[model samples]
Target: MDDLRRIDLNLLLTLHALLAEQHVTRAARRLHKSQPAISHALAQLREIFKDPLLTRRGAAMALTPRAQDLQRPLEAALNQLTSLLREGAFDPHQAIRHFRVAMSDYAAHLVLPTLVKRLRDQAPGIDIAVCQASREAMLAQLGDGEIDMALGVFPDTPSNIWVETLFQEHFISVADKRSLPLRGKLSLAQWLARPHVLVATRPDADNEIDSALAAQGLHRHIALVLPHWSASTKVLTDTDLILTVASRTLDPVLHGQELMQFTPPFKLPRFPFQQAWHIRRDSDPAHHWFRSTVMDCSRTSPQSGEKQAVSR
Candidate 1:
């Protein structure tokens, strides 16, 4: 521990560059140091580790077996340290990061396109991977770092997670403009009478519309059940099926189709669409940028209140 304390932190930086570049001159250029300085650091690192980290192979420098073993773990340690040290300032333009997000299809349709466009314009090197998972699975993934963030309606979140409401989305009924007589608002009786298409991705998932109907001892004639939002478009376009969907999901699902949207007759609770991440990532600069960008993109109204930041 005393020897560890005596070690210079800058040597770790130099070692990182040396291991990455493998060549003295290149490592010197990368570290903005003279060749002799990099050589000295490399010699010291060799003495400390008792291994010649880099070896000369004809004309090029090759990593020794010990250096090859150290590559991944050392890089990971340095990266974690860098992230810890640079918690508040993130330069998006030059940053290279892959962000994994867990979201439902509805949230993806509502948020990803706009988010992608903004990312392209601002942070070209950043990449995104979207995963479809249940609320429980998403929360687990967030905890395990399998996913960086989650965007959906997650109620009763655990204390270890942080959540920020992006918007409040209410259910709306959509139908082919030519097939349905949509005037202003849809009545519950009219909604029940029409052949309805239900978007149930999972069998056991509780739907707000179904819950609302069940409370009033009412049920709609479910003509079809689809696992995806895009599947409803073709069926709604050709048939007389009226599909109930989140208001934000309407525009993307009915991109070129002629669809009429109206408020549902009964008062269904407006669910909060939120972005959640583990509490561990609350102070991460890149994570903060991602949360802010998603919030900005998905906010329906300026009047939609922002929740206070909670850290555990």
Candidate 2:
């Protein structure tokens, strides 16, 4: 096509490396190309874009204003190109790659550790990083390569982003051992009357679960707003306030807490937890491997109505 001829796609990629390393030798090493070939690509790029994208400094290269502006767009394009050329079929056991992911404290607690060990044995060169990032930031992180994927919920997520439901995590009432609720399932009337603690990744998240309860014309009383479910375990153990948390959160010990699944005060929806990534990374082999590992963790975790017992 005409578009293909005008844009020497390979030049965009060479420029990306040149701009990043600020040295042809280093960039050549990264791209696994000969230094002279990268130089030729840079020359072609300068003529095509009609700008001296980079200039020589004392011992390194510096970007012109035009080059500075091209950083994000160029990196995004090359990453896309490289991802497309990558073998779509991912092989977990033989692959060597880095997979950086963003997840809530809850998900990190419930997942990842198991996979890290498996990756150690199955794919020794594979590197993994799991850190916390808000849903608002997930999209930008995915696009920029700061994170290849994120695990959590994104109810009001934007359309530009892509999400796959990893699993349906159900809620269970959790409390401290001293104040654990009755062992048997409590009736809806009994549940609504008790004071409760609500946990969320963000302030608006509190409203999400509350709004769902409002739709049924039945709502539970919330006595506290906590930052994470881990903190709630401490509250529920020391106090009688029922904390509605995912049953998966029960795995990690919290100073001896007791968890019980009680009949909801009304019909409660399952937490539609999922892993979301940008469309740009849809074809990346490394990204695919990381996502598949997380999905495997989710599928293997306890499913509906099953109980997990834990202690400090």
| CA displacement after TM-score superposition, residue 40 of candidate 1 (Å) | 37
Note the Cα lDDT for every prediction shown: 0.78, 0.68
Residue range 55-126, candidate 1, lDDT tens digits: 999998888889877865775577678678886568899889999998878888778889999999999999
Q: Can you give the lDDT of residue 155 in candidate 1? A: 72
For model 1, which pairs clash? Answer: none
**Alpha carbon lDDT at 138, candidate 1:** 88
Which residue pairs in model 2 clash with each other?
176-236, 176-237
Candidate number of the best lDDT:
1
Residues 157-273, model 2: lDDT tens digits: 543356777778776665554553446555677777878888765655534557777887877777887677566766665566777767777654453435444445555577778
lDDT of 2 at 117: 76
Off by over 4 Å in 2: 1-85, 88-96, 143-145, 176-189, 217-219, 252-259, 301-312
Residue 283 C-alpha lDDT in model 1: 47
User: How many Å off is the CA of 151 in candidate 2?
Assistant: 0.2
In order of listing, the candidates' clash counts read 0, 2
